[model samples]
Each structure stands twice: as C-alpha cells, then as structure tokens.
Target: MAHYERDLTGNVDDLVAHLDRAIPQGSISAKYEAGSDHRVGDARMLVRAYERYSALGGNRVSLCISVLAVGEEMSLSMVSAGGSEAVFFKVNTFGEEAFLERAIQALESYPG
Candidate 1:
C-alpha cells in the first residue's frame, strides 16, 4: 500500500484522464470508476495483465489503484495480487513510489 498528499485540485474526469495516460496499454483489460465522496473526488482502477507472464508461463497479474482528492489534497493507494487469492496471484515486484511519481507527473501535465 502507498499514500500521497498533494496540494492540487481538479475534477474527477480530468484526474481520470491523467491516470489513463499513466497506465500502460499492455494491460489485457482495465476498468475505471470515478465519483465523489463528501465533496472529495475519488477514482478506482482495476487492471489485468497477461503479457508479462506469456514468456515465463506464469500466472497473470491483477492491479488495483485508488485515488482520493479533497480540495488541494490527494491520497493514492496501489495494490497487486500477492497471496492465495481468487483470479490472480500477488507479486510485490516494484516500488509504490514509481507509480506515485507517474501519477504526480500526470497531475502536473493535466491542463484542467
């Protein structure tokens, strides 16, 4: 799990658009949901991947990312399958900071 607080503001649509650019197209499938909670904007994403495991003959990957925004503050969390689960196995192969950096970049570049 990861957490971030930022002094930025934007609509959920704009935020989701920025996130869309951050995610890679190699994802086999992706789902996104955006809404507001107590005046705070929120977005959730689920992504499934099989491309990385095609060569290794390994299990696929399932990733979930959630973002919450209120005023000039934002919090983000990302988790991947890593334990005994239903559809995919979890693997903590990368640092959350990497994803956070990409999100920050996206937020900065979004004109809205």
Candidate 2:
C-alpha cells in the first residue's frame, strides 16, 4: 500500500472537480468507483474510491481519496492498495505508487 496526505487552502468543490477530471486521465481502464459527499457544520467532506488496471502487476489497483474542508482550508488524504505482483505475499508496490501518482500529478498545479 501507498499513502499521501496534504493540507491545502481552496474551495472543496473546486478541488474535488479537479481531481475527478485528472485522476483518470492517463488510462482507459482507470475510473472512479464510488464516492460520498457530506457537510457537517462548516466542514465539507468528500470520500472517493477509484480503480485501475495495472499492467506492471497484472492486477487491479484501488485508490481512495478523502478530503475535509472548512471554508477555505482543506485536508486531503489518499491511499493506494492491491495490485501486488506476488502471489503469496504483498511484494510489489509499484502499481500502487504509480496509480497514486495520478493524484499527485493532479495536485501539482493546484494552488492549494
């Protein structure tokens, strides 16, 4: 598994839209699987799950993203798992990292 987290300053809706577009850009098999959006008090929360076929590992990898926002401040968390190449053990993590990179790349230019 691979994980990433970041603290950002931006509108939750904007960031979510940006991710929704960029996360699935490179591969045809990449897709958003599920999501939840909630607002409690002043905070808005979004949780999303995505999956993609990993050729390097010959399996499907899953990526999950969570965002919590209060006004203009936001916190983002991402995790990637599965797609290990080993049959008996979780050895290869390249697929997870690679799939996670799509989100990283998406955030590169975000002014958050």
Candidate 3:
C-alpha cells in the first residue's frame, strides 16, 4: 500500500493532470468495481467529477492506493484477467469527492 496526504488544492482536471504526472505508463489496468463486477466508464468519470468537487473545498486528504496482480483461479476473478493487475484506493476523512477523484486518478495513473 502507498499513502499520500496533502492539503487538497486543485480541481479534478488538476488532479488528473497530477495523476498524469505522477503515474507512469503500463502501471494501471482498466478501472473496475470494488468486487470487480463491471467495466463502467461512467464510474471512472464519476470519480473524476468528485475530485473536482473536493478541490474546491480545500480539505485535508489522505489515501492508500495499492496495486495487485492476480491469476485466473483467484476468488476475486470477476475482474481479474488471468494475471491482470488491479489498483485500489482507500481514503479516510478527506473530502469524499476529492478522495474519490484522487483514487480514480491514482488507479488510472499508477505504474504497476
């Protein structure tokens, strides 16, 4: 698990830009649900919108994001792709919107 905490400042776009800057290529796989149930592009978009909303509030933010690689026979195989990678963002006390945005950005941008 990797952790990041900061006095939040910036919009979703800013966070996305930050993510683009922070994460390297070939790190993150496609975004999926918590249980790895679905492939929803709109879910990713919602996270982006939340990040933008949090940026306007200047809230204290903290996050724990992790990357995992799982094989085909795993229990959480719904989203797994026969040794695919997954990223998880866990937030605490931060602006919900901001935290979610950062999480999504981190998920999308992280280098596996």
Candidate 4:
C-alpha cells in the first residue's frame, strides 16, 4: 500500500472541487466516514473505492481513496492493492504513482 499526507490550504468547497477533479476515470463508490452525515465536505471524512483494470486482461484490483478534514485543512489518503487471488495470483503489480499523481499534484498547486 502507498500512503501520502498533504497540508491543504482552502475552504471545504475548494478542497472538494480539487478532490472531485483528481479522481481517476472509473466506476466509483463513496461514503461518509466521519463528522456530519452530508455528502459534501460537510461530512468531514469520506472514503472512495474504485476498480482498476490491467491492460493484459486479468483480474481487476480495488483501490481506495480517503479524504478527511482536520481543523481548517483537509488531507487525502490512498492505498493500493495487489490482485493476488485466484486468477490474479501471479498478475502484474499496479503502479500506484500513476493513479495518485494527479490528485497529489492538484493538492500541491491548489491556491485556495
């Protein structure tokens, strides 16, 4: 699993927008993990999981992206999975850097 922590300087709206845009293309599922029950940044904490496919046509892996708020800032956490089960027992490892680069970059560059 890969992990990253960033100090984000922005309001909830700006943070949400940045997170929303950084998500990779795939069918995603999200839910509140803490704080308020609302769907937006009001939740204070959110977890998203999505499927990733390999080019060689094998088992798909499930990766997770978690967002949480601390005081006046927010942070993103990403975890990678190795599809080592059944057909994916010997499959190639996924490159998590490619998946998270955009999101991390967005956070570092976001002005607000």
> Against the true structure, whose lDDT is highest?
2
Candidate 2: residue 55 Cα off by (Å): 0.3
Judged by TM-score, which candidate is best? 2
Write model 3 residue lDDT over 8-110, tens digit each, in one string: 3223344444444443221232232222222244222212111122233333223323222122111100011111122353433234433444455554453
Of candidates 4 and 1, the better by TM-score: 4
Clashing residue pairs, backbone N/CA/C < 3 A, model 2: none
The TM-score values for the models, in the order shown, are: 0.42, 0.92, 0.25, 0.55
Error of 2 at 21 (Å): 0.5
Candidate 3 weakest ten by summed lDDT: 73-82
- Across 57-90, the per-residue lDDT of candidate 2 in tens digits comes to 8899999999999998989999999978777889
- Badly placed stretches (over 4 Å) of model 2 are none
Q: Rate the local accuracy (lDDT) of all candidates.
A: 0.43, 0.89, 0.30, 0.52
Give the backbone clash total of model 3. Answer: 4
For model 2 the TM-score comes to 0.92
- Model 3 scores a C-alpha lDDT of 0.30
TM-score of 3: 0.25
Q: Which candidate, 1 or 3, would have the higher lDDT against the true structure?
A: 1
Ranking by TM-score: 2, 4, 1, 3
lDDT of 1: 0.43
